[model samples]
Each structure stands twice: as C-alpha cells, then as structure tokens.
Target: MLRISQYSSVSSQQSEQQYVPLKHVSVETFIKFFAADVTIKQVFRNDETKPIEAVYCFPIEEQAAIYSFIARIDDRELIAQLKEKNETQREYSDALEQGHGAYLLEQDEKSQDNFIINVGALPAGKECHISISYVSELDLVENGSRIRFVVPTTIAPRYNPNTGDVSSPAGTTSKYVQTAPYTIEFRCQLEPLKWLEKHPPRKGRVRQIFLLTDGEISNVNEVLDLCRSMATSTRIFSFGLGHSPSRSLVKGLARATNGCFVFIPPNTSVDIHVGEQLQKALQSYISGIQVDWNLGTTVMSTPTRIPPVYANDRLIVYALANDP
Candidate 1:
C-alpha cells in the first residue's frame, strides 16, 4: 500500500500544503507461496505555468525491499541508480540548474519506513509517470494456514519542531480539476492453493454486521458489552464519520467483535473505505492450519503462540535456530 504527498520543492515550508494533482494510480500485486511482488504506477500533471521540482513522500512496510524505481517524462525514461546520499543530491540539483530532467529516490532521513522521491524540472502542462516495484516476504497467519498482505493507503500527520510545521494529514480532499474525481485501479493475482485441491473444503460460517455512524452512542458501556458477547458469532465492522465522532465507541465495537474499523473525515468519499472493508469481509476463511518444521536443529520462534490471522493478510514470525 502506498500513500503520497507532493510538494513544489524539498526545501519548501512544511506548513504550506501544496499537492500536485494525481491523475491516476494503478497497482498490480502478484502472490506466490510466501512472497509478494508489487508494482505501483502513478501519474501526476503539472498545472502551474512555470516548471517546478516536485517532491513526493510515501510509505512502505519496514520489512519490504524495493528493487526498482523508474520515472517516465514525456518520451524519456529514467531509471534510478544508487549512490552516496550527498553525491546524489548534488547531481539532482545540478540537473535542475542545467535545465535537464532528473529523478531521485531516497529513504527518508527520519524514518526507514518512509521514502522520498524528487522529480526535477517538470515543465508546465506535462505529465510524469512514476513506477515503483518491490518484493516482500508474506507472513503466515492462523497457525500458518493463511497468507496476509497489506498496502497502506494512509499517512498520518507528524509535527517537526525544528521546522515548526506539521506533515499534511491524510484524507484531505484535493481541489485540482483532474483529481476531483480521480480513480485508482487495483489488481491482485494469487497462486492456486494446492492444499485446497488436496483436502475437502471446510463448512465454516461467517456472520458480518456493518455499523456506520458519527459515533453518538448513548449506552456506550452496554453497547460495548453486547458487542463483546456477540464476538463468538458475529463480526462487526465499524465506520466513524464526521469531525468529532466518538473514536472510542467506534473502535471498541470493532475490537470487541474481532473486526475492523475505519475513520472517515468530513467531505471525503465514504464509498472507497466501505468498499475496502467489504472486500475483506468477502474473503474465504481457511481453517485447520498447521506448520511442520523439519530442520535438524532446535528452533525457537517469537510469538511462541500464534495469533488469530485474517484472510489475505500477512503475519510475520521471527525464528532463531539453535545448534544441537
């Protein structure tokens, strides 16, 4: 999952919120056994009259490794190359000064989970396509029966005391003409589950209840207790809407039922978030999961006990092998 924020320059004031209009985004994910390969393509257009350097910040899983970054600018394609940070920055600045196009990808200084992309000297009215590809090991969950993968779609705001500025909050509506009705296309392909072919399908049942509200619950304690009692038979997905919804109540109900929760700010579309929840609800549940270790050594695994795993989600487990 990727979240993006755009700025005119790297040195621009963080308080000044300026975003380049996102025209389209396409994501393709391929899953094979315990690994996933993901590719994301994003198109951004320059509407300002003058050429501007664009800065984009995005996040990925801490364990995910990125192997490719490519930028397409009006008949020219540039592939990113690795170099010392200072040297790369110097070359990027030189390219801008010489009126040439340059692209730079670097890990964020403050956080390893985040990355920064610089697109230098994009001319007015032009469009650039940025593609990023990465591969990550999928986690086994539900006693090693199901595989889970997640792509983050949101970036929470952060305050920087040094700059006296705050990172832009997620879910802010875009005002660009092209972005007002932007669309994101997503596709996922998974390898066939050989175990399913070998064993009979289980007769499992799933009961789902969706709750959407502005978080104005009167009997909060009673409601939460009721949700907790229904955990054995029901899954309650909750959505909190508006500016001042009761986050505690909304999140509590979902937590009690072992479900999911989403918070939608004012003026943002509700369908997208709802659709995502619906997709998760529709995944088939696999049961009777078991893992067999055959290595000739004593192995200790963190999370000595397995946690409940959701369908199509990743679970990471660390193991240490001890020689006999």
Candidate 2:
C-alpha cells in the first residue's frame, strides 16, 4: 500500500497545493518452505508547474526484514545505506539547499510498522522510481498444517482532534484535484520440498479465520452457535469496523470460539490493532488450558472451559462469587 502527499509550507493555503501522483506499482513474491521473499516497485510523477517535494508513506509486516532499497531518476541510480538519523537528515537538507535531487527514507516516529520517504527537488514532468525488497517467515495456520501470507493494500482514515474531523496526511488528493489512474501488477511463485510432500495438508480444515465487517448480520444467534460448535477445531478473530457494526454479534462470535474481538471506531486506523493480532496468531499456543480457583466452593466462572493461551499474550478470566 502507498500514501502520497506533496511537501509544502504551513502558510500555503489548501487550495493552492498540488500532490505527486502514483503512476505504476509492481509486486512479486517467492515462497520456499517456511520463508517468503517479497519485492515491490513503484513509480511516481510530478505534473505540477513548479518543482515539488513528494512524501510517501507505506506499511510492511512487523516481522519482515528489509534488505534492499534503490531509487532511479532518469540516468542516475542510487542505493540506500544505513546511517545515523540526524546525520542523514543534515545531508538531505544540504542537498536540497544546493539545488540537487535528494531521497531520504526512514521509519515513522509513531509507528514501527510504517515507513516514510521524502523525494526532494523533483522538477515538473520528471519521474522517480523506487524499489524495495524484504524477507519474512510465513505464519502457520490450520493447526500448524498450512502457511499464510498477507499483503496489506489500504490504510484506513484517521481522526484529527484539532480539526474535529477525519483527515489523511499522506493522501494523494488535494481539495480541488484528484489523483490520476494507476496500474498494479502482482505475481507469486511457490516451491514444494520433499519434506512438505510427505506431510500433506488436510483439506476442509480451517483452524483460524480473521473476520472484518462493517455491516450487521441478521442471523446472529445462528452464527454464534456455529462458531461455538467449532470451538475445539477453529479459532475466530473478529473485527467490527465503523459505527454501524453490531457489537453483540461481533463479540459473541469471538467469545463462542474462544478467540478475540476488536472494535474499530469511525475514522480510525486498524494497522496497530491488526498487527498485534497477527503477532499473537503466529506465536505458540498452550492448549487444554485449565484454571483452578481456591477461593471457595461458591465461586463460579463465566467460561467454564478455558481457551488456548498464546505465548506472551495477556489472558483475562471473569468470575462471580455467590457470597462475599
């Protein structure tokens, strides 16, 4: 996913600003055994009348390790190298002062799952091409029988407190203009090994499901009962989006399956919560969990059956006492 904006002074009016537009995007992934390698390429163009700076924000998997980053402008190609943040910022500023094109990339201050790139001094009608590559371990799902890989292609809007409204800082659209159409290409390759063939995956066995919905369902009780029946075989993580989602249905499904639920308010980003859930899903879990209470014989718990406990995850238990 990509979010792009134009760099301008704070004094500039919103109607006078123009943003860089995305031209093309390409993605390729290779999977071998339990690991995956991914590469992404994106092109941007400046169609404004004057030279402008471009800012792009993108997200990556929390467990991924980026190994390569390169930028190409016309006949020149530059490779990124790790350096001190302050030193790199100083150098980038100096390049812009000297009337030279500069590119700077850094992780976002507030979130480690996102990155920001600055392209300075791009003249009108010019183009910039960026390519990035990274590797990550595939997550095990379906009771450790299958692997799952995901690529996020969108970022939710955020609420701004000062303006009392929703806003997107990295948006490509301005108040008076909208971005042009862009093209995307994607491909994936998988290689099977001898060991994988020996232990083939079982069909029709879904161990986990992440459900995100923004609307209400009419058959809430039926869905809850279905999830409860599959509790021993499957775990369901539910997310309710926007203000219109039915909280009772969303929470009931997760409770029945002994999973987790998240409520995303209107105009809020789901990246942080989604990342946290993904990490928990990938960790080792302790099954057949049992809780013993020493308070008294009158003590009773809401959930008589304990759910599977994951490593490094918090667990909450609710209990009620007839006598205090």
Candidate 3:
C-alpha cells in the first residue's frame, strides 16, 4: 500500500535510537482532460499495513468534500442506485463509451435530459484507484441569452453558477438566460446572432473561429486585425462583458468577418433558460441564430431585424423590449 509522505525519510541515534517514516512524498502523475470529461487517478504503494490515498492535483477542498460525501454510504448500494437513476433520467439519452476509466456523453437527438445529481455516480471505494466522470452538458464559454453548446452532453448538466451555463447562485431560469463570468448589455452588441451563424466556424474559403472577449481592449479593429493576422480564415464571436466602450467597432469586426457580437451585462444575476437550445447548438451545430423582429405590437413600421434570439425549447420569447 502507498502512503502520503509529508517529509523525507528520517532517523536519529544517540544514547537511544529513534526512526520515523516520511510524511509527504512527491509523486507525479501525467493527466489528460478530454473535451468535456473528468479523470481521476490514485497512487498506491506495496504496504499491507496502512491505506493509500488518491492525491488530487487541484482544489484540495473540493476533493475532500467529494470524498466525504462518498464515505457516508455503502459503495455497492450507491452504484446500484446511480445506475437506476441514470436509466430513468432523461438528460443522459446518448452516452459515449470510452475505456473502463472513462466515458463520454454521446450527442444524440434526445440530448436534453438532466443527469441525476445526488446519486454520486463517480464514487470511489475506500483506498481504491478512483476515476469518476458524469456529464457536464454546457461548455460554450460564451456570454448572452443564447449561448449554445457545439458539443452535446451525455447527461443533463445543471445551469449552475459554478457550471458556467447559468447566471445565478442557484441555477434557476432557462430562457433569455444569460450567464458569463462577466456581462455585456444587449444595446452594445453588433452583427446580430444570425449573421454570425451563417459565417461561423469560418466563412468563405476561410475557416471561422470563435473569439472570446475579456473586456480589456479598446480597439476592435486592432483586435480583429491582430487575431486575423495570426489566422485570417476564421472570425471571432466577441463576448462583451466588462467595458463596452468600443462596442460599435466590435460590432463592425463581427460584420467584417460575417460574425456577430453579444453582450453579457454585469447586472444580471439569474438563469432563466436552457433546453432545446442545448441540442440546437450540439446537433444542429448552429452556434446561434438571429431572432427575427416582427412588430407584433401596435407599431408595424419596424422591419425584421436580427436580435439575440434566446434559445429555450421551453419558452421562446424574443425579448421584453427590442431596439437595434
């Protein structure tokens, strides 16, 4: 059995003799994280006396919590319960089977079901080599009411604040749901979502690429030129969350690449939507669509304009107000 050593081996001998084992030993394990998968590895030693542990590389606190949560129950019972829940949960309709150590969620047509939480599918037996992976449905890395996943999930991922899919502390709401690490106002966007969709992944003889904004630069043309200079085949889906001083120019670059611009306003703090859109992004590979503006109101003079269409199969409302 292996053990965690805090210090190197030590021994002392004077009129008396004393010896102690090392407290911490440095052990390095090469790791690889797939597109939307998790990997867990445990190290073991050949000692029958003490138990070895699965040392984690990051977030010792989170590892401890998962371990504690597992420690409170029966392993076989837990796995059995998890299997039953998985079969029943609608979110994990398609699953990609990998090696014994890992599996990926296949992007199937019915990829809108939520993975069952609290079941603890990724559980580790005491002192065993641990590798657990559930599904994390959302990984678009975008901000706005219409962020879609180009890749489908094996299980229904929650719109969690930590999950990067929702914009709230508890992950509520499903449509017009905007949640990024930052936010950009809708008024500051350019090109509209649909225009970008037509030219995304890359346009023309060139390949389109998505560019995320950290809200740092003041020059949109400069950013576009610099990014394109590195590779001109693709475009950038500029996400504006912080300072939108260069909003107009940013919008222009999107138009330049036949791309689009979106804003994640910092004031928003709740998730309102997430459904069929997830499938739209994954299966359709439709990064986004421009919602058509029809003045259903008394004012009929306004023509059809592409605004950020919120993707929620649950409820598809354009917006409470429209301009641009």
Candidate 4:
C-alpha cells in the first residue's frame, strides 16, 4: 500500500468523512459499481490479488462489462460468503463498516440490496474521524478495535464493477448464476481483454476488423485506411516498432484508418531530441480530439502509446501521458 498522508482534521463524523492522506479524505462522488483490469499476478491459489480483481473469466471481451467500486463496514468472511452465493458477484470477503471503508462493494440496485449495513467512523484518542476513499463503495479495515482503513502501499482483495457477472440480476436464485437473453457489454483494450480471455472481442456490440495483409501492415497509411473504412463503430488500429521506422506509414495510416498512429521510442537507445519531438506530434494529434488540450503551451506529461479501448462497436486508444 502507498503511504497515505493528508487527511484533514477535516470531518469529525463518518457521513462527512473523506479520503485522508495521514488522516481523512472525503468519499464524496467516489461511489462505484465495479472495476476491471488486465494484469494478473496471482501470489496464491486462494489468496486474492489486488492488481487484478477478476470476478469472472469472460470467454470473450464482448462478454465482459465494467462497473464501479463500493465501500462499507462488515464481516470479511461474511462478505466472501455472500459473493460466493451471489453469482452476479465474483467473490467478496471481509472489511471493517465499523468495516465499511475497508471493503469496496458495488452500488447497482440489484446487488446493493443484498448488502444491508450501516457504517460510521472510528475514534482516535477518544475522538472519532470519518473515512473517505476513491472507490465507489468501501468498508473500514479492523484489526481488533483499531481502524487501519487506508493502506496505500499495500492492497488487499477489492471489488471492481466494470465487468459483468455470469448471471443476470433478475434471475431466480436457482438459475441466478446463469446469463439469460440479457447482458450489457463494452469492449476492453486489446491487452487487457487478452489478459481476461485468450481471444479478442466478438459478437454482441463488438465490431470485428479484419486485416487482409498476409504480414503485419508495415505502412501506417495502409493500417490507418483499414481501421478507418473497416473499423466502423469498432475499428482496428495497427502499428509496428521492430524492423522498419516509417513516418509516412504512420501519417497515412492515421489519415486513412479511424484510429491514431503511435510510435514507441527505443527503450535503451532513443535519442532525447527525437523522443521529445515524437511526444509533441502525439500530443498534437490527441489534442485534435479534446478541444481544450494545449499541445505545446505548457510543460505537460508527454503522450505515450495507449492500448485500445473496445466497446460494442468501437476500439478506442487512450494515449496516456506516461510509459508502460
């Protein structure tokens, strides 16, 4: 967990609590339904991993969904039992509401009804301070009577709301763990989706873009055209970094393809001037999308290649301002 510091002497009560650094911060506007990710570092068979909170193994990215996180105070063991019983939820366990801020839960009306608990703040030096967090929902972490709610550097098993479950919310208990004729899905990025399912997105609202080239598209223009015309609501964005460095390839591809062209710099030998110039180009491209962005006005975080974001009919690339 990252070391937390700046919680204010802010609130004296839980309802007015916040996500504090050393002390307290507000949970205002942090409510969520679930969360999802690609990386999986399983330390143990039963011991959960915080980096990747996989609720279910989506056979395809199209079958998956996303939700927000929630928090509350409750029994850790009891939460797990409830999740196990609730097929809609992948797995849930304990936290502190008296456990409320410890566990992150879902806020969907369907699953929320299953969680019936009232939470409050813990006292310090005979005085109580409220809890605040970024998760959609939360529970306090209790050790005996002490509350160690926010541990930034260390993460325990938490809930994510982005992915859908195996069952429907309206399904009967006996048949609850099954998907009927209903399911809402969004496409995940290629790498993240690959982490969840061996295959990529298909069916539902996902649009499949087929590359006709026998080999990988070496030209950015050719790749961009394929993405632009073929991508539709769901399009494919392609580029390569290994053998050839083609500037024309990227520019043309970006123009013809529906997605942006990206070039990743060499890790060990990338020249500083070249790297900085490339950063400017990428920033300018992204800024074209978001009207308020200033590509060269300020010393901003340089834009880096982004993994694609998939939805029923789209594949979006979020060019982050950092490296992997």
Per-candidate clashes come to: 6, 0, 38, 92
**lDDT, candidate 3, 12-131, per-residue tens:** 111111122222333222222312233333322213232111112111101011221111122332221233434533332221111111111211111111111211112233222233
lDDT of 1 at 42: 84
Instruction: Name model 4 segments beyond 4 Å from true.
Output: 5-10, 13-101, 105-257, 266-324
Off by over 4 Å in 3: 1-77, 80-87, 90-116, 120-131, 134-191, 196-210, 214-324
Top lDDT model: 2
**Per-model TM against the reference:** 0.48, 0.51, 0.22, 0.18
Per-residue CA lDDT of model 2 for 25-124, tens digit only, reads: 8889999977789998989988776666676777665436789889999999999998888788778767766667788888654334456677877777
> Poorest 10 consecutive residues of model 3 by lDDT?
59-68
After superposition on all CA atoms, how large is the RMSD of candidate 3? 20.7
RMSD of each: 14.1, 17.1, 20.7, 22.2
Candidate 4 Cα lDDT to native: 0.26
Candidate no. 4 TM-score: 0.18
Considering lDDT, which of the candidate structures 3 and 4 is the better prediction for this target? 3
C-alpha lDDT of all candidate models, in order: 0.61, 0.62, 0.29, 0.26
Question: Model 4 clash tally?
Answer: 92
